[model samples]
Target: MGGSGSGNRWRYGIKGTVDASKRLDIRYLKQHGMLRSGYYSLSWNRGGEPTGNINVRMVSGESMTVIGKWRRDASEEWQPMEKTVYLAHTACAYGGSRSWFVCPYCSRRVAVMIIDAGYVACRHCLKLTYASCNEDMIDRSWSKRDKYKAKMGGDKGLYLKPKGMHQRTWQRLRHQYYEAEMQGWQWAAERFPMIKDWM
Candidate 1:
């Protein structure tokens, strides 16, 4: 089951794809006024459970130092890791400015940075792909359908719109949900002929 055959077809390499969901967004920090000369803690959670966290000290428009403990893999012991990530600002079209993190390895400006191999870097430098990239059409469609369903305030079915949502918006979302649902069913039926009967 662990061989490099069919079982591991979707498995990524040793330093698996960096999780985009768990990232440091310079935009978020700037918007929340966290880009100041102070200390902050960044954390991540999975299903209401704490997974990991890091401490960041901001130097306001210059750079931010990240302090955390990380390990390459489960076999190795966790080690203290500290690195300073520089910041870059670009002018926006309308007005004001936007912030980005300068990738430590490539020196590219990126809005989000992920921790990989005990260091923080942009996704490109890490050569990582998103988990959704390995998903098939059926999976993508199901995800979209579920997202719209949840927006309408239920997971079982799309019957009524959630309160405070406009009629036109609800109609649009319902149509989108139905389309995604049908697409998911179509793909599933193609994979398993028996599923066509239920459809």
Candidate 2:
């Protein structure tokens, strides 16, 4: 829902991922050093501008255009910015044309990127870790229980009426939530003997 990352949200279960397009944002790509830093430009008609200010020149026309006069870095001499990216939009029974964005740094075509600290780079460059790197079943269960409790309106009681729901359905959900929460407590206790103190 919210940015659970960059904060402590006790994340568990499968985490929702960012959109594919956002990963290729020019600003992020440059910040991550996927592209060299210089007076760069872009020529994409994706309809909206990315939230960065690395552009120095831009030219638009018809269905295509180009941004250029940028270099690998500011200190270095200015050069052409590689703004020509191809996104294959057709598919057949065999397969579909993949949407590929070229990395400005290496000129390799790819679909996803690692965005962190306002910088965008390929996974290899960032050396990122999975969200579940430190996850354990016990914390996961507890997170699930918290979710259930939130859905039922806080962890105080199961019988509290949720607005606009059928009484029967609400009762069934309350029972299910109670069981899950108890199980979460059990799981957490198994991992940490002092967990009962929090309960």
Candidate 3:
């Protein structure tokens, strides 16, 4: 039980007995609400053992205040409390490329090489989106119509002029050619709330 003074906060008895020198695991801290909001998960990247003195006080009635910081062993400095952290961009690809392709099923911006693999994957969530694509599907659906072909000059075709199209036209055609891919990218960006830092 808690008093009005302690809103959305908790004080555990372990704090009193445990030595300040002892580092507490993140999983244990989370079970105790030592971490604050905004952080997605406690990881080695942004969390570490507990450090420094803790502020423990019993207020009026049953209220109490427990304050401390964790000695996070990450690239960044220590994070005083537990916070929800999320990945900024999906780390799906191994190497960087100038052109980013979206998965048809998950809509995640994937590296071109990933398409060679049977599965299309989302970096944030390891969801296998589409099975795969074949040349037949590309030829039938993505290739331009005869009229469109003529409009671009009878000698030119969609695939023939993929790079030749204006940036605006290329963007529009890319969306149309890879509707499923675009949808996957949009879904990932929309479904997951943007976080300030990557977990």
Candidate 1 yields a Cα-based lDDT of 0.80
| Local error of candidate 2 at residue 73 (angstroms) | 18
TM-score of candidate 2 on Cα atoms, chains taken together = 0.43
Better of 1 and 3 by TM-score: 1
> For every model shown, what is its TM-score relative to the native structure?
0.74, 0.43, 0.16
Ranking by lDDT: 1, 2, 3
Candidate order by decreasing TM-score: 1, 2, 3
Candidate 1 error regions (>4 Å):
1-21, 148-157, 160-176, 197-199
| Tens-digit per-residue lDDT, 1-199, candidate 1 | 2221222224455334556446888878878889989999989998899878999999988899999998768899999989899999889999988878999899999988987668788888777777766566678888899898888888534676677889988888899999999988887787678998887
Pick out the ten consecutive residues of candidate 2 with the lowest summed lDDT. 56-65
Give the top-scoring candidate (lDDT).
Answer: 1
Q: Which candidate model has the greater TM-score, 1 or 2?
A: 1
Those runs of model 2 whose alpha carbons end farther than 4 Å from true positions after fitting are: 1-86, 90-112, 116-133, 155-157, 194-199
Clash tally, candidates in order? 0, 2, 15
Cα lDDT of model 3 by residue, 1-199, tens digit: 2222132112232121111123223235435664333222222221465323444332222222333354435565654542111112333377632223344455555432121112222332332222221112223222333334444444444445555668677545444545644443443344343621321
Q: Name the candidate, 1 or 2, with the larger lDDT value.
A: 1
